[model samples]
Target: MALTSIKTSGDKIEIVNQLLLPHTTEFIEIDTIEQAHDAIKSMKIRGAPAIASLAALTVASHLSRALQADPAPEWLSSPQLLDPYITAQLDFLYTARPTAVNLGAATRRLKHTLRTGVEQGKDASAIAQDLIQEGREIDAEDVSRNKRMSKWGGEWLIEQVKAKGKSPESLNVMTVCNTGSLATSGYGTALGLITYLHETRKLSRAFFTQSTPYHQGSRLTALELLTLKIPATMLCDSMVGSLFQHNDIHAVVVGADRIARNGDTANKVGTYNAAVLASRHNIPFIVVAPVSTVDLDIADGTAIPIEQRPALEARLVRGAVYPFTLNAQGVKEQATVMVTPEDLEGVYNPSFDVTPAELISAIVTEKGVAVKADGASGFDLSSIV
Candidate 1:
């Protein structure tokens, strides 16, 4: 619903390249499926939902161009030849990022289009047309869903504050990791909730954790909130407890990587730490994500597969040159600097950490808000999902 991440000019698609982000704003054109796969694999573009949207959009762009090519591809000439080709491409894109369930969902939607067209005995040309429309819809639907969830979560937070005999206006909220324009199709999830509060004149400030190792909070989330002119502050990953001690944070909001059937949430590695600290401080801990993030198959957090990033990634930092050094083109020179000792031993780098349902005060999706039963340690998410 928002034109933040995906920019389109006729048939072309370009995404803000995420690998060279924070210090530099470079938008790379993604005209082919291969480029989409490479961008996701190399981390040139990331954040589960965003990556999936790009993958789906890439296919749409490719098909759009193919339909308008100098000569239609032979596959488009016949129904039998085109089905397998499209199926293979969707499957390939699905593998780009394994941890984000959204990618899988996007691929599955595309596959459904393919199957329905075939089972209905549509010609190859008609099937291609349907797929191109479906692909773009996959990306388009994300933003609207994000907006709905943001409204649900944001309003719920305000009501919770008022019910507790506190002023609903001027609420201060803390969020972990990036859940903004750069992380989703648009508006964002948890960050969207924060933005909603700001827009409604009920927010005082938004405090975000640095979300160490990846620094999605410091680098990406900070840049996004600033762009939207939302009042916000950034704190290091280690300062969650300290922030709670001094700040009047109304709640701690976060985005989910995956949600198990029992309400266990898997999110950025530092999210569990924040949830633990929020519980200790008697603050409401909220999870905001699309219903697609709910994994009914997973019985609990233990069953959710956590992706472990390469050890080297935990020891390096990449940024533009500091101290006001300018490049030949008058731009800052960017470089990757290793932050760890020359020879370091074992590094524990998990892309996500599971937050038990007990620590979470509420789970907000587009459907509705789900809270744990009175004095319950876990939640039954079946009805909600």
Candidate 2:
């Protein structure tokens, strides 16, 4: 299905503003490196891969514009000047989201292109042209890989269900956080798997957690699923146990923020809680992310750096006014409300939590699915990486 994120107009590119989502559907034009960096840092545009793609595409757009200018830019006339200028821009965008490796990978790829072009003794304009095409490829590749991983994960789940003697057509799956269209350039990771099942007529229903603090599931995932016309139900972060007790859920799929070599996963903060519950119920727990999210440098979850969000975010809730006042465009106007008492203290808001490998049932990437070794508690992702 065509997603709202990848809207191409002849040669122009724009992305939906995720910060104002659900309540507002604003498509912001991304024409410069500064805009891409700001969108990522401000959470106006997010999802690790999606942000990376935007950053790369912005660089491509800038160069494409430069190439077509009547007199051509001065920077394009000198190889030495052009190299530093492009390197600085990519590095600046890299700082916007230091945690996600994909963003760094994208920047590094561009840097490599620049250095290689220079070493090859190419002229300034030739190097600029090479960098531009490479940048566009970086953005275009993500959606294709995402679609591949989604299909792989989806098919595996169906086969697993059938092995249990259950009809794959009636399989119900649960997921945590938002891994739908908004979470990527398109398709998504784990959510993309759910979408694939629905598209092929093998899914019974899709259940998602509210993914609290951020509420990515409630706000972003819900919107994406609804837009696709997929049959889905929303649950609060605390309700995973309740849902498991009553529903015949076949699997639990989640998007990963980072994965250690031993399969310990750092995903949205409440994910470990859900993984624990899923394990108790003997339900399969799947972690879906690009290979870039796997950090071989981090031997285990303890070594992974978990980001702590501001206390204010944990205290406030933003959404459309409950009664819903329509704007001039007939869309609801949203408001922010403090969910906690004034001056609430001791709020713990780590952006993600680590799920030990022992609890994870499988790990899926664009490359392929990695399952735990027989009788082993964790995975050795060295080959995959």
Candidate 3:
């Protein structure tokens, strides 16, 4: 069965608590705007596209419940009040995670919907209805876009291998972090391309890095591939270099939280290390993300913001016991243990790192695939964006 990050039934919205993933599956509800904001900020729900979808859908659900309230909210009394209230809510959600451009894009799109309805002189309720539909659309559109970009990336890799006089069949591809259904509205970005190759029988194995500190790759991506019955191998973050030296890796693919206009990508923190290693190995490094992940306002990676995680996060690890005992509820019992000394200091833990465009062989989006021009150091991105 496929893993889902968020589940919505009618007006209800629930997301899987990714922090306790692999060992356990837990669902948490988001009924209020504050709950959605906390979910994104607290890292209970993540991935650039997934968080954005949750933020948008939560707004839709909030408005839906308000429209059916015994006494309509005062904000619904007029377009003026409703507009500001919803705008404030969107703005708050955007602040939950500043690094992921998709969250900002989702908020901006809803803001646009609100502006269009208000300009048409629609009533407060009418404008609220418009916002609801737009929010739902934002979440609904992610899956199709993911599939399109995955296909574009998967086929492009095959062509690249074939051009080098090598067979595309049984190609081995590597990825970092958890870019799968659990990381997005549905399907995925980088992992989606690996899934595409698997479905088409062109893949021999799927390789993923353990993604240090958070272990999204080990805890989340490993579970995703297992559930899908995809053949996969896990390597510690530092093993990437050794893996490339010992194996015939065709490419290293990853999902982007943000991509500057020149194609520099900000993704999982260890992504840059993987990109640098891929370059040394002469392996193609591809980034697969939706067009929304592209930030036209940012000219390069230096301008992109990098989120720093709590220092304690890097010192501890969470997992089930060695014997893997299950509680009365048949759920695995998990615990967090410190890997370093209690008073350890000077631990650096940034949530993401930027890979310069020169290291990126191609940037795949729903629109198409983008590659740097001959002898060029950066990508134009005009055609893909």
Candidate 2 to native Cα RMSD, angstroms:
2.0
- Number of clashing pairs per prediction, in order: 0, 0, 0
Ranked candidates (lDDT, high to low): 3, 1, 2
The numbered model that scores best in lDDT is 3
Q: What overall lDDT, based on C-alpha atoms, would model 2 receive against the true structure?
A: 0.85
Span of 10 residues, lowest total lDDT, candidate 1: 1-10
TM-score of each: 0.95, 0.93, 0.99
Name the candidate that leads on TM-score.
Answer: 3
Write one digit per residue (lDDT tens) for candidate 2, span 113-194.
Answer: 9999999999988888888888888877777888888888998888899899988987799998887778687888998999
Residue pairs whose backbone atoms clash in candidate 1: none
Task: Check candidate 3 and list the clashing pairs.
Answer: none
Global lDDT of model 3: 0.95
How much is 228 displaced in model 1, in angstroms? 1.9
Q: Tens digits of per-residue lDDT for model 1 on 117-184?
A: 88999988788889889888888888888899999999999999999999998999999988888888
RMSD of 3: 0.8
Which 10 residues in a row give candidate 2 its minimum summed lDDT? 1-10
TM-score result, candidate 3: 0.99
